[model samples]
Target: MKGNFNHFKILIVDDEEEYREVFKEILDEKGYITKAASSGEEALNILKTHSFHLVLTDLIMKGIDGIELLEKIKEEYSETEVIIITGYGTVENAVAAMKKGAFTYFIKSHDLEELTIEIEKIRKIFYLENDNEIFKNQQKNSKYMLNTNNKKFIKIINMAEKAANSNVNILILGDSGVGKEVFAKYIHSCSERKDRHFLAVNCHAFSDNLLESELFGHEKGAFTGAIEQRKGRFEAAHGGTLFLDEIGDISLSTQVKLLRTIETKKVERIGSNKTMDVDFRLISATNKDIQKSISNGEFREDLFYRISTIIIEIPPLRDRKEDLPNLIEFFLEKSKLELKKQIHTIEKKVMERLLSYDYPGNVRELKNIIERLVVLSENGIIKDIDLSKYRVDSERDTKSREEKIHNNKEVEEIQRIRSLKDIRSEAEAKYIKKALEISGNNVTEAARKLSISRRQLFNKINEYKLR
Candidate 1:
């Protein structure tokens, strides 16, 4: 797993001790770390304590046949690629093993040279992936900067940097868009594994079944459309850091599996019986209140305790308004460069209005507004009118439509009276208005914010008969 190349740990599994010894002798000459197993049961047991990069398994083994061994290996130690070895008569079984996730197969009659070539291929792939991660880490370090002037925020960042000195599980609690991922990356950048891979996955994005496959990997035919064997995020993040965003969204079943993996440093791929050893520092983030979730029986308390060995809570943008200026300045220059604009300053009044406004979407919303200004402002200085145009009105409009209808009977009647189409139209109009206001009434910018075509937004504008 370490070193540039030719450092793969390999296991050879065969019922015939003689064949196993012969394979070991040939592989030893190639400088690979080789271990031999005489039966499928022995191979399974050996895999529990040992971590191997590849396994050369024989197909006609007695007791737990090769096909069964292949399934077990793919399920548990998915990080280890399996190659099925068979005689001419068992070629059919070898093909079946491939469908079940064997990496590839070799014929017993063929020269061992063929097996050596396959091993070399796997070695090259490992080197390429490792080097790519190092390169990406270097690139991120050069371009990303965590700029903050808030004293409390600074102290928290300092704590994170100190935590990075040791291997500890980190839990980041914050509202969305508060730069949780920024802190996660900062920790990784400061850690000893800085040069290794830093991978992140949003746990809320996939369904439970899909998430299982994403975290634990799957064999070629593990499920429909699996098509080919794939490595999960955990496998990819081995010897590095893995940031699981929205960890609270994972189901209880997944929480159990995750807790086990953290405890044992091993994982079983979906539909695989083999277990793979993984070493990674976990960093998880969730916008949801985890304590509240545990009380509601939606999250596991034990898992929470396991992951929160170190907790860092980031204050919302509204609470940490003191950091606004530096953040604004950073985004201002970024927008200018991105848009190739000459805008360099905001009017004093405009700056005051911005500082007073509540950013419900936090830093992400602020950056979006800054970019809009850079692209639309005719002058180098953003004026008061520009600030007014981009301001979100939800803070100003305290009494929403639903709030005005206080009577339960009236609310029920209104809901019953309005068709789904009519209600959807009304909501769409409100959002369009809000998007238009936030984009300074620029149709193109509003369309972009709504993630719709400019022409479609224009059509809706006409349909609603909006000025």
Candidate 2:
């Protein structure tokens, strides 16, 4: 009565013909689309063919009772709420049903007023959920509204939308700074869990012990400095979405615990014996080649399968260069507002330079570049500035192309030609050196930029004698 009840569909599951007809007739008269199923099996069959907002089922049935039906519905169609219908004698069983995820239970009576009240409550919940999702979408518009024209990226967006409607664990893979976490948040914002907390954790940013405590929480005195009991990301994200960034970087031990928690939907805090049940959609992301990590025994295969029910791979900025102009404009406006600069025009030469350079740090690098330009602009005009000051490798890229052309000419004029393998090795060495330079000679960071394991990069360095 409080909300639009016409959109709500109710399934009445009862073996008794009279009760089924009575429930259906009552709900239909109340303006709810109602369907009747003689048993739990019939209800499940109906569910496969159609969607329902709620299911009203009798606790005592011939086969596949109310509790079993509730479990199946929660396991599959989790968005559908269930209310158990019990006789006076089976009230205890109905209570058990509530513990197992039933919305509520009602005793059979001629009055049937309690049934109508329960349905109204569910409708109110639906109304509130719709309002919350709309509000959240509006709040997140500026932060997550990534406009792209690339066809492949558009398809990825469509796939993400479909994935959002279901309760599936997602794994987003891309290079560093390619907006994997942003995509994860987009999925969360488009999901039924949008109204709830969207908690994110960077797995690569913490030590093994700290990461474990951060994910599973820690009681007071759990460790040397853990003076107070604190809830972890998983607990804090209950009934919402938990985003694990750089998921491939987590240790195998932590992976094992994560796998168990995901499987059981429960977690035990450090120094606490009690296990708390948590329900949260998992959306993990990593720039690393996860298959290589699995082959190298750095990540668990079981955990990978569990978290990667739906995998979304994002293209690097270089591949989707068509979106560069729009992205540049967006970042330019954003930077202007943030820096409080009245910069109005970007020089043609400056725009050309911005478009030509391959963004090794993807969108994030472009944003930084725009912000830097805004900061350096004089007299409200953006003129050609020294890109090298920002560590942009455009000059180095041009020199590399020149050197490559010179090398090709030399190879053609020489009597004895170099083998293809040798040529490839030389090119690879130069690229690795460039990556190292871009990462300030930090081997770990260079490896990440190269999309290879640190050990693999170290082996390549030794093979090329570059270190």
Full-model lDDT, candidate 2: 0.85
Q: How well is each residue in 1-467 modelled by candidate 1, as lDDT tens digits?
A: 22234578899999888899999987887778899989899989999999999999888867998889888888888878889999998898888888899888999999989988998898778777877876575446323435666788778888898998999999999987777877898888789998788888878767799889999999888999787687999999999999999999999999999999999999888878999999999999999999999999999999999999999998788887887887787778777775778876677876776777678778767877777667668868776676666544343343553476754567776767668888778877986887788678999988866545676788789878767
Q: What is the C-alpha RMSD of each candidate to the true structure, in Å?
A: 16.8, 20.2
Off by over 4 Å in 1: 1-145, 379-381, 392-467
Error of 2 at 414 (Å): 23
Per-prediction TM-score: 0.59, 0.58
Count of backbone collisions within predicted model 2: 0
lDDT tens readout by residue for model 2, 64-137: 99999999999999999999999899999999999989999999963698889988999889867876785565
State the number of backbone clashes in model 1: 8
